[model samples]
Target chain A: MGGDFGPQVVVPAAVEAAREGIAIALVGDEAVVNAELAGCDAEGLDIRVVHASQVVEMDDKPADALRRKKDSSIQVACRLVKDGEAHGVVSAGNSGATVACGMFVLGRIKGVQRPALAGILPTEKNPVVLIDVGANVDSKPQHLFQFGLMADVFARDVLGLDKPSVGILSIGEEEGKGNAAVREAFDLLKKSQLRFIGNVEGRDIFTGEVDIVVCDGFVGNVALKLSEGLATSLGRILKDELKSSWLSKLGTLLSMRAFKRFRKVTDYAEYGGAPLLGLKDIVLVAHGKSNQLAMVNCIRMAATSVRNRAHEHLVEKLADHQGLNGKSEKSAA
Target chain B: MGGDFGPQVVVPAAVEAAREGIAIALVGDEAVVNAELAGCDAEGLDIRVVHASQVVEMDDKPADALRRKKDSSIQVACRLVKDGEAHGVVSAGNSGATVACGMFVLGRIKGVQRPALAGILPTEKNPVVLIDVGANVDSKPQHLFQFGLMADVFARDVLGLDKPSVGILSIGEEEGKGNAAVREAFDLLKKSQLRFIGNVEGRDIFTGEVDIVVCDGFVGNVALKLSEGLATSLGRILKDELKSSWLSKLGTLLSMRAFKRFRKVTDYAEYGGAPLLGLKDIVLVAHGKSNQLAMVNCIRMAATSVRNRAHEHLVEKLADHQGLNGKSEKSAA
Candidate 1:
């Protein structure tokens, strides 16, 4: 309801998910959702409609909305997770609101210092998971270390990476390169048991140098958005340039097979959506302007996460790591 | 010479730059440079050879190189500019070494807080100038404001944008939605005479919302590199996808014109090279794997910067803005 094309794009996607034998609970204004689903056949689909009295505006502060708007759709969906009524929650609304609701309603897992938003980006080699992509903007080195640990567990349980190599994004590939936060994080990450691949440059993110790339929310958000913008602008430019001249047009014809492959590689929609990791329950946040196909994909991703028990796995791993560190200190003393 | 493709790609570029009537100074080992340029026609080309004793390894610490290797190629090239023997210096060598040598030799202009590396990104509307792309990792709010001032002047004098709108890169576009550093910088930039566009999100950087984008070196470097990686990966994927199937091949044939247009739009070669802004003399840094055409274009960009006196114009603008701010504060008091 908050996106530029929220209810419109989301309605058909929900219907499709029901037809495909996936259980879905549509949390929104009861009247509006029912109106949109009036003509669609929701047969044999475990479709439940939850009524919410309010909506969170995109411009509203997330913390304030969580505190004040008690009956909001996002808050209601999150509450279901808190009460074990729902396995996971999916939304295409305000990102901050969703994150805030998740943190407040579900609360952080024990031993998890901070929650980080993990975004799965489509790279040339498999998919790269970027954590802290706008969750904790002002994070300490310990928070970054925790983010790396949580992401490592999620990737192993969900993405099926045996031992994900972690990389700290920096200006250069050297150890002593970035700002104060990154430099300090590098020192900590290097000493950890995780497979730290030393420091990685921005260009290395897409090259698959590491499975998990960690940074503060501010830098991660910037890097993610910039990559999207460049892909978009480049796609538009390629379309324009291909039509400019006849020779280029013929060359493009000869190279058509290669071009389709290129399109799939750059397509973000195919990747489904980004998961807000460190949340107590599974919550997938799709792009606001997502079409029916993107929404369907997000649903599939959510189902996969729920089936894999990603959150439980993450919590267990974090606890074990913490326990090991504490035991080592006692022995040393 | 330390890049993936060394003399094979760089030698031809030097020859091409010389042929384009740009005074070329090849600053590497004399034997290697001469051997590479030996086969090419040297007629009517003002090409000179400057010999340097050392080459800064890419893996070497930037500060250590600056402090220890005083007679390196990067240092010698920058020295030529300091002594007025050359109008500009172009290198495809170590970026940190280049920045270090340039700062130590050419020196910063008066009242300039820090020198930033600004990359002109090809966006949706027009080219957007992103500054502080890896000069100062840890920066104060004052440094960011100066970066905005410098980027604005560069856009006006170099890129030919009239009253270029400047934006501070942050997680959110709202005024109060950033870290302590960004918040302080936002306040400072709002008070400056530059055309401040408040705060901009990561996605907006490529949307062409503002002509100039400013951030700390850590964030800027990550943004710039991530964009590069995405572009490269996208191009590779499109080529692979187009060749995947026969039907997609036909679609590629139909869309060949569009594909070429897309390539042209994403082509960094068209943009020539990124100017190392805030240096006393014009300095253009080419990518290590830059082709001959790219090197020639870099020379063209450097010549334009020199002809327009971009650095001098920027210094003047900074002084004027500082004076204006001082007077406004005095009047208020």
Candidate 2:
């Protein structure tokens, strides 16, 4: 019901994941879903076609669609979770609309300030989780601190890290080196129970020095997209250089296989969807250009979250740490 | 006086630039500057040394250093500009301290709210300018607008553009799609005489769609360093993948010269220093790791800015468009 391909690519991927024993509720136009499903061999699989009358276009305003399009695919998907008919909802449509629906329909966890998107990137050492990549643009210090707390649970439970270390994304590696929000958030994290490392510079994000990097949505989104842009620009520049010379043309021909391996390490699409943390239920937002493989991977990742009870752990973590027990600042690196 | 090599590298570069017809005033400890100056044949060049009693370490706070280190090299360099003994000042020292010294020593230009750093980056098509990169972290709306105002003058003067289009850095390209500060800044830019191109996403920074990208120092710094980190990581990944196979070994060997060209397009040091804008006089802040060539390039860049009278043009533009003469929002891409 979302993304560029809409039901065309999603139907088959949902059927495939359903075949893999993950129950997938396909929410979109009933006619469109059934028509796409007819092409796939989804007989006897745990796949249900939930009729969503309206579709949220990518350009639709989030608040506008949330207020008017009650039966929109994204809204209907979230309603499935709210009504206890589904464990979670996955949408590739309007991310803003999806976030709105998740917040308005599923509601946030107790004491959670804001539900944020945890973007996962393949780094040099390990995959780093960047919280609030594009959700909740104007964040407060408390919201940023909550981003770290929620991302910590997701990283530990879903990513299988026993005790993930966290750092605030800032301009420098010093204690007092960021904007007002980051400075305040640093104070909050330093007083928490998380494995809080001191400040980390922007370059430290992909180096995987820490498992989790926390920042407001604006900076996180910029970091995510800037890294993607740089990688793309680098590839284009490398290819142009390699093709300009006859010797390099031969080099390119010989190194074709290695180029594929390089793409695997740099491509963010190789990973599944980014999880929308701080929500009562597990909702993952796949990339807008997600293909069948990506959809299947995202569905598989969501199933892992559900099986591991990541949301419950997040809720418990919130309840257990209602008040800052370790409010004494700890200077760490 | 600054950077890793300090006077050792600065002396030879200053001598070379001075020989090339740019006057150089080497400011640092008299004995250390003389010892380094003795290494180079700078007798006929217009290279003079000024004695400075103290040096500002990288770890020293900007405010503390500004208030205490009276004769620091950076302060002395800025003082030379203020006293009209030098046209411009260039330092590869602590950037925060440099900005602080530039603000207090040289004083802010008339009608300028905050002084900022304009970082130049080489994109696929042309070099792009990112303003307020780690200069002032918490920027107000009017300040972001002023950054665009000042950087527009810089792109036209130093970068040599007729009409450089400006865009506010945001999570999306639509109007009113960013955080609170960006949304307000968008409104301010739209009302100005500059060619405001609505909002630009993070990945668009390298695509060269717009000439100037304006944002606060926090997000701008993240974008700058994240791109550098990704480029470095990509190089390492490509080398590892290419060397793992004998076929790619041949490819890597043949494409060595082309790789040098790739480095030139991506290496930020090739562009030399970033200019700290909105000051009464020209002040360029070079990278801390600037070598001899980088120092010379930075000095040359400063000279270019000085010769073009970028500061005066900025002041003029600030006057001609003081009030919002064009406040009507013209929708643009």
Candidate 3:
């Protein structure tokens, strides 16, 4: 009901998670959800089925989903977290709708100005967290600073980094390398207590040297989408070239196992989903075409993020940093 | 003297170009240029050494390079084009210095708002041109429209794409998808006579469906650098995974021929250098770590661009389009 695979992938994944002693709620059309669940070993597992009357289509606008789809699975899941019935919510649905649900249903964190979406991209060294991947496109310098602060807290608390290095994504690494907004953001980040590594170019995103890369949503989204497009294009070209010749075809045959491992390492399914940070509750948005493996990992990520108390740490850290704290709810928006 | 590989890569490339009857001018410190040239089969080649007293370091600011390093290799090359001693200029030097030299030395074409650096990225399909890749950041809607105009001209004249479809790069493809600048630019592109394909997302860059993907310098630069970083990182990860086990390692050995073919197809050197479009004279900038192969391709690109008379076509087309024309030189800037 949520993803391209619908309840088929979601129910099996939920059943597996329940078997592992993780509490799970399947939020979708009850009839469809039960049909998919019937195929799984869900007997005596810690799982509950929650019904929602509407579905948010892939092409549906986020605003429309928020307004019309009040009884949508995504909204219900988010409401569950808001009501303290669930620690987190996971959706392999329309990311824009999921982001909207996170903000509109759950609301923003106490002092947060904008909730940033962190796209966790895996590198050879470690996974790099790129924040503001299209959550708030026209971001201000203060919003960028808040993004940095929240990402820093999330990196330390959820990602298990002791002291994560935050780098401002720009055209160049030089102090005055970027546009006005970036330069102003740099000045703010320099004064912050977070381990700001100064400006990092787009090339630095995959280096894995920096833990948290912060930017306005437009730039981050472009970087994320570009990586995805290129990776797919490159893989296609590599495979085409490998199969072009007899010698290469033989080599590909012998290397199938290695290729599988390489795919696993770079697969979006392995990473599961990206977390929408700066929200009051945890919300993870998986890819729309997420499979069973991806759904399972999405649940795992939600559990981990909830267990780590990322939102609480974010609140505490922001409160401790006087510059980011003490804003009234009215001023926060 | 320009790139990291310096005279070692540059001299041989120049000699090779000269061997093919492409008149080549080797610009750098005279002594170092001669020593490197001696290693080449330069017995009787159409090659001349142009001595420049200074070298623009990679970290040197563009303005500093323009004002202080007057006799630098990059400056000398652009000056050659300006003085009509050379048809075009090519340098595997600092890109900032290249763009600055192009603007200051060669000047911008009449009716052109800003000269953009078009980074030609190779894909499985036809090569796609991404314009304004760090030439002029904080660009206005007018500047972005100018980028599309210039890139469209370059694609047709140099890249040989007849009536190339130009798309404005943004976070989404919808007309109203992007930030303020992009939305404005979208309106402008639609009104213009160019083959505007509306807005394209980051994922569209590699599909090779669109000929030119235009954006402000900052966004374009991020897209370019991110692609380079991800391609390199992905290749490394794939190779590492292939060698992780003995079975896969054996496959890699068998697939060595196929791997070489794959590398060749995806090689950046094959594309040579990116042209700084909308300038009065052609100026191509190669990568900083460009080897001899890249240098050779840069020269080839420069020659092709010059032969196509891209600048003249750009000026004529821009002047014809009233939306861009009717501006004095002062107002244009």
Candidate 4:
């Protein structure tokens, strides 16, 4: 079973997805999956339960889980995609294991150097794609360029942007302002066919200045999680403030609609299921703490990706990516 | 001449700091400094103006500025410290140049591998020190370990934490979860005498779970700026919502005290200037966009560091650092 609540949360989410007319394969402990499924109204729904004997624990190492847990829920789910029984895989469980399963089991696209996780976050105007959030670390410049290429293709194909501007994340916005990898990656991106918009700082990630922000997995993951942490901490502070005074308490009720509107703009769950980019098959990683609603939204996103031929586009676009990045291809890796 | 509104901002701030009984030697172009100082109420204050011909533009490369701007204001300020004319240097100008000046002019403490910038950020409970916010990049394991060590001493001597808990920033809070350097640093930190709290994720930075979070300059800088950007963006969204309706306007007035308290907890300026640690003398780098109030606090913070003998503690503690980290020292660098 994957995620925090395993079958309990996932089953209801799958049922909801099925009701939304998306076919879902509930791959988990058969007994538990069945028990949870029995509680849902699943009449005439195209939802099937595939038994997975083992679970990938949150603390399990990706490599260890990949090697030892062949029958793990994440593995079985990925296997369904490889066998053509499923269009995509969605998991809220061990994210590292999900990524491992996606890479080792599902394999990589032909021209892909390293498959990465693209975290879609809401900005002021639109969704910004931050690639290589945590899929791989210690990335070479070539890998970062590929992450940019892959994310660019995703933004155009899935997000329906006509032309996506890409920016490599750095400490400063200047040409020679980043670490060795970023400095080199800047050159690679500058030579690429994608609408490369030089370097952007971490502050620029949430500014919606560019459609995609490319970084090595380590920094990207740190930035991603830091954003979430900051949001939570700020929310807690605001909540405490709103509750401190009787006048503010009255203000809270009157300002309820404003808060709701603010939530719609800031909620990461609103943009569900960040797809692991450059993979041969679709594998979406939901948050470890995702609820039933968030998971259902993730499943919906997975189905939408399949419908949009997101994987096929990545495969085809990477061929162009290689040719477009020919200048730095020799020096980047 | 370093940051925006150079003399205008720095002069008023220096005047304010001097009014508080802190001696300030303002290093800048003579005529401009004199003009700004003439406007300020500097009567009975310990403030002096030292003329420097050149100004280090914000976009100037650190190395370029170091080599070319020898007569720059920042350098003159650092030279003042080096000549023992001033106890410390405080600059709201070019940070990279400021770090370079701190390192080259004042020199590093014995056994210090690299000088770093330790940014002090406010959390709910206390201030957290994030080291190497933008001093250097492409950090080795030893560099990060040193950052942790330096920040630990900073927390103890300056922030008044008796035994500061230190954590290496990583994707996961496990021993072997980060990149190669972080994994190596994690082990090194574990072996040290400092209260090594194992690995901490980016989200833990604001939780006040640890007194110090150590990362490479690239990632640390990104994290620092991202926090500032997030606060601004979120504030914008909240303001837009609050102003949308009439009832929320009344609520905002009632919630004024709460918002003020929230700002107090979140203001980076409230913590004053971030010191450039590992230097022989105290050098504090304030925000480039620092207002008069912010810069005044920076000067006060610099004065406080000198009074606290922060440099003496770092030099003394690093000897213990070498011994405690004997297992990884040979391998870390």
Candidate 5:
């Protein structure tokens, strides 16, 4: 689909996925896609290049792009999901555009008020799933509950956790501390049937106390970006420190094995991609500046999602829960 | 004055400040402070210990502490400011308690409705100030506007910027993006006298496009903590990466000088401490786990705040602006 480097990275990644027994429908400009794939061999694989004239720029307004450029790559990819032509859509492009396209074309799941972007963050213990990372800006208590449910389902199915505990991000771990929205969400979460672990502070995000952390897009996005910036800045700092003296360089050499293990744990690329939850079809959004290895890992992740039928499982669980809740309400009445 | 590892770190830091010709007033358990200073030389230095029995734990209710524990270190320190006994109060204690203590004891500056905790984050280009980090959770548009003004004053007086550019943290750079509070804040910021740089995304916080970034406490706290966690994790990861193989170790040795430069840039200790802005007195809050060096640096930062007369400058500017605005309103009527 549409991305920063668009067809160049997309074509090769698509070919690699196709070769690995995964059907890939590349949605972009036909000429551009073909030009990218001109030198590559996609033999004995189901690979199709869908025509999309318009390309959504990273700077373009999501609503404007969706409204004005209906035939954009993101829109076309979303249309494939709507028409049941593809099992999922993948993009490394404008996050807002992807979310807008998904909502507009695929539509939200029944009983799910707002869709959230779930980002997998590497923690000391395990990868923590953070939901609502810039998908919906203004979220209600009900929306937060739905987001928690959806994230729980995703973590259980994809992350292979038996019962993933969810925590609502707040200023304090206490029962009645936070803004109006967080307080309301906390109340709703406490009353829910899900495995809710109450409130978690900002410092607890990396401690891995809860598998799933639910927050509004504004808070989640800030957390996610701040983490990224800090990681980048720290990496730069550590590299500088190792070169300070000859003795430190020797110490670094002696502790090389330990450092490698640490690198493996902190590498964001190892997580592959973030899943756009509450969509009809699976959509994995890789980092825009992702290299070849990250792209390959993303394709592999996409294949896993499709094979597991993650979206269908989420839909079924959400439907069953809603049905049971409705029946309970009626009985109580 | 107040913190997790209270008298131990605070006393030594205060002694160091006194040695450096900065007046030191230790507002905590006098016995504990004297015991910690028994082995160290306190010659020809103005170091006085004020007794305060109450201590605020990390999990304690801030408002409750302010109401009940009137003689707590944080409260007493703030009272010193109210009574004109001290120019500034520094603490590494519970942030909530500090904020509450400041509000109740020191009171807000004229024309400032709410105070904010301004955390200085080290970025690639320069250090950026994040306002309202874990202070007032539920913030209104007017509160955010006041936070921007306070941050601007801080950058000018403390950070030494002539006209610091302020940015409202949003999902996108566009004016119409973000939630209700941010949207309202954006409008107010645009109309204000400060240098408003429009909306900035979460990713832009580290890019250093603006000197001061304004947000509600929830988002700001999450951003600050996430950045801290990410930096620590990334530093560990890079140390491991450099030891992966012999070639990598060699490369690390060759690039030792560059690596040290990088670490210096990302070192939080180098920044000293963060100021709690919008209060009548100068108050600096250091990290909870700050060592003796960090504490000493915090004292140095407090001296800087006192020397710059940050509190007096802020109060004068705010009162003058309020007076001018009031006159304009009367004339318009």
Candidate 6:
């Protein structure tokens, strides 16, 4: 009942995940979800339906959604996590609302100053995590330093890295080439015990030179959206150019095998959803227009987060690192 | 002698521009410039060598470059324009050094508070201008508002757009979506008479939805470098994937023409160098690794700025718009 395709896509995806032996909870309007699930085998699987009386529109403000939509599917899904009925929550609904509900219901980790959204993007070498990718704008230096600590744990636990090299995103590779927030954050990052690689420019994100890139939510979000837009535009232009001539058409036909590999390497669907880190419970937010494959990947990601106990690792890592704010156990809210 | 290839690429490009009836000045160590000129028909062309005693290294700080390297080639080129010996200046040198030289030697135009660098990028629909790509990192709200005004004129006269719709880059497309700097800029843009299109996210930059996307230099620079890195990485991956199999290799051979066209469409050489806006005299800075084609385009862009009188138009436009800083005539230095 979330996203542009609503239950038409979500129902099929949830059914597929259920068949794969993952416990699934369909939290939405009963009648609407039932009508979509009529053709599926829901009885023999571990899928359960939990009705929610309200819905949060994609454009709904986070504050309004938290206050007005108490029985919204997003809120109900989060409540399930808080009540120990579900290990984690996955939503393709409005991200802002999801973040609000996650914060309001399950709360942040013990020492987390600000919970950040870790956007995992594909690179030539391996996937890299970009933290705070639209979660906390107008971020302070301490918040940014905290983001690096949380992401360092996330990259190791979720991404399965032995030691993730965390790099602060800035305009230049030098320590002195960033704005006020970045300059202060640089100092904090340098003092930490994590594999701090100093300042990295935007070019370093896709080169897979670092395992994690830390930035304020505003800049991180801009980089993510810009990459998406450029990749789509380039793919479209390349396809049109190939189809413009008969020779190129023949070439494209012969190279179909190679194109598949190329597409697989660049596709966002394979990366599933980004996780909201520094939270007490795992919450993954998929693209609003996610297809069945993306949804399945999201389910897999959520289950993996539960298995690894990523939040626990983040809590320990923060406690272990030098206190950037002079206190490690202080909660933001 | 500026850029990685220095006179090896710059000399040929100046010769090509000279043949096309554009007067060219090669500002560098006379011996090095003349050595490269020996490979061309410098005697028959309208090209002259202007000697500068020093060269500013790429890693030099902008302030240091301004204070120490008074006779640097970058400084000499701008001095040529300032002294009425040349109508415009083009340098494939260190961008920070170039910006400093342009500001110090040429100064800002009348009624301009802060000059910006416009990085024009190619999109599927058309080219869009990203203002202040690395000029003003800690930019004020008034600085961004002024950037929009300056970019509006730049798009109209240089980019050939008739009333380009200017959009403020933010996390969301909503009017209430950006950080503090962006939120304040939004109000100023709304009150202005220009074809302001409200807020646009990073996705809109490549979609060509807006003619000009305005942001502080830090964000703008990140977007620019991220795009460059992604394009290069994608290209490398696609090429490697194509060559991995015989079938794909044959296909690539057949689609060579289409691939060429695709490359041409996305190539930065065709777009030329980004202009340093609000300068009293026209100054263009090409990429540090600029080749002959990019240098030629930079020279052509410099000539275009002079013929279009972009600076004069900017002066009038700043005075005509609602006074963003209460006075546009204030200079930085």
Per-model C-alpha RMSD:
4.1, 3.6, 2.7, 1.9, 4.1, 2.5
TM-scores of the models, in the order given: 0.89, 0.95, 0.95, 0.96, 0.89, 0.96
Model 4 RMSD in Å is: 1.9
lDDT digits (tens) for residues B1-333 of candidate 5: 455577777777778888889887888877877788785788778988778888777777888889888888888888887898878888888877887887778877777777888988777777899998878776877778778888888888778899899999887777988888889778777877889999887778887678999999888887777666666555556666676777667766766665667666656766766788887777788888776777888778777777888778777667645744344343323
User: Which tens-of-lDDT digit does each residue in B172-244 have in candidate 2?
Assistant: 8888788887898888888888999889988999988789999999899988888878777778777788888
* Candidate 1 residue-wise lDDT, A1-333, digit = tens: 555577676777888977877788888899988887776776667888899999999888998889999999999989987888788887888889988898888888777767888888877787898988888877777677778888898788778899999998888877777877778777767778889998888989998667999999989988888787777677667756775777657656766656556666667777667788877788888877677788888887787788888878887777657854343333323
Candidate 4 lDDT tens digits, A92-206: 9999889889999999988788899999998888889999899889998989998988898788777889999999999987788899999998887887788999989978888
lDDT of 2 by residue, A49-144 (tens): 999899889899999999999999889889898999999888888888888888888988878878999999988888999998999877888788
Cand. 4 Cα-lDDT = 0.86
What residue runs in model 6 are displaced by over 4 Å at the alpha carbon? A327-333, B327-333
For candidate 2 chain A, the 10 contiguous residues with the lowest summed lDDT are: A324-333
Q: Write the per-residue lDDT of candidate 3 for residues A1-333, one digit (tens) a residue.
A: 777988888899989888887999889899999888888878998899999989999889999999999999999999988898889999988989999989988999887878989888877678898999888887877788888998898788777899999999998888988988888788778888989999998888888999999988998988888888887777777788788878778878878876776566567777778889988889998887788888888898888788888878898878876554433222323
**For each of the candidates, what fraction of the native contacts does it recover?**
0.78, 0.78, 0.86, 0.71, 0.44, 0.88
What TM-score number comes out for model 3?
Answer: 0.95
lDDT against the true structure, each candidate: 0.79, 0.87, 0.85, 0.86, 0.78, 0.87
Q: Where in model 5 is the C-alpha error above 4 Å?
A: A238-267, A320-333, B238-267, B319-333
Q: Is candidate 2 or candidate 5 better by TM-score?
A: 2
Mark the 10 consecutive residues where model 4 chain A has the least summed lDDT: A324-333
DockQ of each: 0.50, 0.69, 0.71, 0.77, 0.38, 0.81
Of candidate 3 chain A, the 10-residue stretch with the lowest lDDT total is A324-333
| Per-model tally of clashing residue pairs | 29, 1, 0, 1, 12, 0
Docking class of 4: medium
lDDT of 1 at A330: 39
Q: Clashes in model 6: which pairs?
A: none
